[model samples]
Target: MTTTTELRVATDGLTKRYGGRAAVDGVSLTVRAGEVYGFLGPNGAGKTTTLRMLVGLVRPTAGTATVLGRDPGDPSACARIGVLIEGPGFYPYLSGRDNLRVLCRYRGLSDAAAESALERVGLRARAHDRFRGYSLGMKQRLGVAAAMLGDPDLLILDEPTNGLDPAGVAEMRSLITDLAADGHTVLLSSHMLDEVQDTCDRVGVIVAGSLVAESTVSELRGGTTIVVRATPYPRALAVARDVAGANRVAATDTGIRVDADAGVAPRLVRALVGAGIEVFDVHSSERSLEEAFFDMTRGSDSTGDDPEVSR
Candidate 1:
């Protein structure tokens, strides 16, 4: 299938400041249409600030952003975009459907569109329930439904799976994927590296309010690190020590722990055999997305170097 290359969103030197402190420093990103773009960062890493800027909840300090080829802060631009920030805003006494109706009124959507939106998020059965009685996951679903109400071309969700259980998280992930399959561009801001790695086609990692890395998950993975079990620890350790790109080589009870660069497993195995060691098993230690996230932002902390404190 041929994929279209539409620039759904773009930022140039986007920045935000609070009380003389830079919450989100100069950053640039692009989310292409029909793509699920993951924005990843740790707590206080400015992911929220950036999203707020994109949706015009907070104005940028010194940069510009565009959504769907127009200024994101413009009222017309808002019509083409849907955002779910923080939590869903709903009247406690209003029924779920009624809440959506109010939002539709604000956006000039018809009653029929409201009903369809509710059905899209699987809340049609509970549409009559008051917002106060809904569970967290239900509220989240309703939030997404509200965002989808306008048939928006772009959706920006911030921490969409904040307080959900495992099953709810799975459902949300699947829902986002389905939305992308339906041709809506999605910009998902999340702190969960594994979730982003699983759901996103492309990712932009931010550390201390700056963009550190941008790439596909496979590219970020770079290579595999494999663990091998072998006899004769001393000889194995010697061989591993001499292997180039070996980050760590240590003696273990059953084998030697080796951290080699990507694509070095086969050569490592052969080296062990050449050293007269009996190799029992070879297993690849795939680095999780969390590990990769850490590796990318390992030393970006703003605090001055303190030998006593560990990151």
Candidate 2:
């Protein structure tokens, strides 16, 4: 567990209910400062409600959350947070710059902050373009700029890459990493597991409105699997199965997969070679984040989130 001093976002038994259906239930999360935290779950998994609660957009039915050491609903604490939730929503007829200027007026910030935000998101050139005329990526950038106008230390972004092309996704990825490097804590909610694996320092997997796993990206990778390829396939599989402490050794179309880390990699290779099997290549790697995610939620269902409306 991360120390309380380093925690910028903390929730205890957090829950939300619409009617009698629990959108979120007993969710506990701790996000440390200076880390890019990835929040992932399938559709209708209560991700949005959880984020909304953290940003004070939605009130929790039970439990509590603290942001920047104060109640999440506290006006002062909310000011310290920058949120880009439910994608970007701007006045379509207004220029992007004008839209931000309006937001600045509401926040009591000067035009300079708006300009800086535009520049940070690489939208200064298109700032004068009407929001309705902007591409999906441009609109997404505007959301990021709005979030930045506060000069906040914490950012909560939901599906920031929803409409980005490959290049745009790359740009957003770099931008997010830059934010973390600058000592800003970020909570990124997205369905892109590969992007999460590459960008986030830690990840929290939610299924059925509850966090099933929370750990650093590397730690989340969990056990390593040694993949082997050799000339003799059947014999190699036989040898792999005989190796002591070797977890799940199964054969694949291309090669055999051995559930063992690097420490036991050499042992597997040595055993195969000693068994008169010509071992060509042997490498160990953690299962992909996507694979692990599916495995975690294989039996889970959003059916549990049935919200029967009650006053």
Top candidate, metric lDDT: 2
Clashes of each: 0, 2
Model 1 Cα shift for residue 73 (angstroms): 1.7
Over 4 Å off, model 2: 230-256, 303-311
TM-score leader: 2
Residue 245 of model 1 has an lDDT of 42
**After aligning candidate 1 to the native by TM-score, how far in Å is the CA of 30 from where it should be?**
1.7
- Per-residue lDDT for 1-311 in model 2, tens only? 56888999999999998777788888999899999999988777888889888988788999999999998778888788889988689999999999999999999999999999998878888999999999988999999989988788999999988888888888889989999998999998999889999999999988878889999887887888778998689888888888844358887876988877688787888888888999888887777899888988897777536352100
lDDT of each: 0.81, 0.86
* lDDT, candidate 1, 35-64, per-residue tens: 999998766778777888788778888998
lDDT of 2 at 21: 72
Residue 303, candidate 1: alpha-carbon lDDT: 37
How do the predictions measure up, each by TM-score?
0.83, 0.89
